[model samples]
Target chain A: MVEVGAHATAEPLVGASDWDGGALPYRVGHKKLGMWLFIMSDSLTFGALLIAYSYARISSVAWPRPFPFFPSIVFSSVMTLCLLSSSLTMVMAVSAAKKRDKKRARKWIFATMFFGAAFVILHMIEWGHLIGDGLMAFELPEEWLKIWPGASPLFGATFFGITGLHMFHVFSGLCYLGIIALFIKRFDDEDVEISGLYWHFVDLVWMFVFPLIYLLSIKPS
Target chain B: MEHQSKETKFFNMTLLLLAGGAVLVAAWDVAVSRFRGGTDDLFFVLVALLVALLFATPPILFGIRTGWFHEKFVIDDEPPATEAAAEAHAEAHGVEGESHGVSNRLFILVWIALLGLTGLEVLLGYVQLRNDLMLTILMGASIIKAALIMAYFMHLRFERMSLVLTVVPAIVVCLCLMLILFPDSFRLFHLR
Candidate 1:
């Protein structure tokens, strides 16, 4: 950590009550709170996208029905499981760090990172299959006479746009986890726990996306 | 100490039951798929319901296993001086000291209720329910699951009520804005 005076920065008032084992006043710090506020704002961005999606769905004449062709549940199911398990490992990592079990914390962090990687891989495969089927991000596959007779471009556009944005977030989160895991030794217990909080937030977001983007779209077929 | 051990056992049993529920649902899917060839859509709905239930089970289980659900940050039972000291320490540090003994049995019951909701949704889908009805049921389930997670796993239930209050308004406003604004935009675009 940088020395408090090296940068000649303004510091909070130092009083006898503020001294607590050489830690900050709160168990949480300003930096962590700032990150959370940023996340909350970003969540609004997603909420807007989803709202736009719902609007598009409501206004469109034909939606090509959202299930069966899209989501490909088997692939998504695996990915969802991977992300969920990563959350469990992340919580375990935080628990270990809180107990000051450095080795266990590192192991759990690595495990969480591994699961994150697996989730990204599965997502890539799902996207590849969709693209291979000619479902372009902005363009839809031509309506087949027999198969997918009612398929429309809007389906591809909305599906890709929503899931693609989510994928971007997932990839970014994976990178974040990987970077943190690399410096696991450097983080204090509190810092490690804060990292875990971010990881859990990512997982929590996916919990919503998995159902909304994948499972809810499943039509009877 | 014995009570703690018993609680632990109860929690473990709850996890096992949830896992067993998932396995049973999966087995049912396999069996029905093999014997009944024409009910593919029904089967898919059943499987989807099971998956949603399975996804929701873990967070509740985590809260139970971690003893977070019933954990109290303020110790009302302690002597006033000790309590005051702890409260002062907590306030100074902006931390809420919590009791570690959470009731696992309560979590298990919550999980079971969630699973039941999932089952209800699947049954509704099977009975040729209206799309709006089915959607509302599923969304309701999602809301319940989200609430369980935020309250239990995230420990929002144990946190300062002010912090909790601060979050809900933001969520509600965002949701309302998205739901209302998008449709209006689409309607305007259609006119163009």
Candidate 2:
């Protein structure tokens, strides 16, 4: 075990209110900190859209609950599984990178990409089914209107907007992982960890999206 | 050391202008809402402006870091003390070892927990509780899931307290501020 206070060259700032503890506030590289900042801002973007959607749902007298249990919910649940699995793989990739095991890290990164691509493909299929049922960005399907005559058309917009943006992120994450995997020799473990942070962030966003969008709007049997 | 490459300067300036413009527009929206007696609109618009200002901070911070603003603004970033401080603090707390090379089993455990929570959320959806009740439960569960993924999968749990403090609070506060619109939903519902 490393000795405590062995390397404490000066007196430690034990209880000072304004003590920064160190010159490096976060003890992270600039790139990692930049990614954290990006995630923070990007979260607000999603947060605004999500809050708007929830507000609309709550305010509307007749918001359409369009997703059925069999196909829509089931398919989305599977997609959730894919994302979760991908997060696990991403963690493994970072661990491998930290160990300087380039081959294992690249393999795990590819695995993560595979799951991410699968999620996107499944999401596209789900969107295809919705569109084929006459769902549009600005318009809801006739069937939904038949059930809830006063349903807001904004349903389609929020649904597609939020999920589409998430899907784009997943797709971009795949591309980002691909770049890392292809150039694993050049990048360091910290680089891998930073990318893993982005990937986990994508999964984290979906954690809210899945339940709020899919579960809340489940169709009556 | 004070000089920045042309590319870095261009990128910083562009981000500054973009975020600055968003803050301006959002602030205008808030003002219009307040003037019109639209409290609900004001809340959301106010939150939007906060988000815009939050977004603007990173670029301004970057500018300060890279000495784009002024040399006076840049703090002394001497290396030896900072590195030694970090290493000593990490060593004292035994944070260095666990921060890296976390076991795969722990990650798999977190994965299973996330899956179980997702299943629970789906089942709760099927049970048909009251709208607000169900929404609360699902969001609670989702938040737990998000925390797990962030802490374990993203290794935030292994990170320094400073980083955790810096990252978590900002997002949590922003999200909570947005929730000021929640009660306004009932107001809108009543109006309808």
**Candidate closest to the true structure, highest DockQ:** 2
Candidate 1 segments exceeding 4 Å error = A1-27, A69-71, A144-152, B1-128, B182-192
Q: Largest TM-score belongs to which candidate?
A: 2
Q: Write the per-residue lDDT of candidate 1 for residues B1-192, one digit (tens) a residue.
A: 222344445654676576667667766776777635333434444554554454445445444434455473432444436443444334423432222123333334444554454445434444565655656666776677667655544444544332444565566545654554343544554685
lDDT of 2 by residue, A1-221 (tens): 11122222233343321132444445577999999999999999999999999888878878998899778998999999999999999999898888889899999999999999999999999999899999998898887899999898999999999999999999999999999999999999989999999999999999999988999899987
Kindly list the per-residue Cα lDDT of model 1 for residues A1-221, writing each as its tens digit.
Answer: 11212111123545322222334433236666665566578777777776666666656655554345345666776676676567667766766776777888889889988898898888888888768767775566564313445444576777777777877877787777676667878877667756766665666566556555665555555
Score residue B55 of candidate 2 by CA lDDT.
57
TM-score of chain B of 1: 0.43
The TM-score values for the models, in the order shown, are 0.62, 0.74
Reference-based lDDT, each prediction: 0.58, 0.80
What tier of docking accuracy does candidate 2 attain? acceptable
Residues B37-74 of candidate 2: C-alpha lDDT, one tens digit per residue: 56566656666666666556655655554565576565
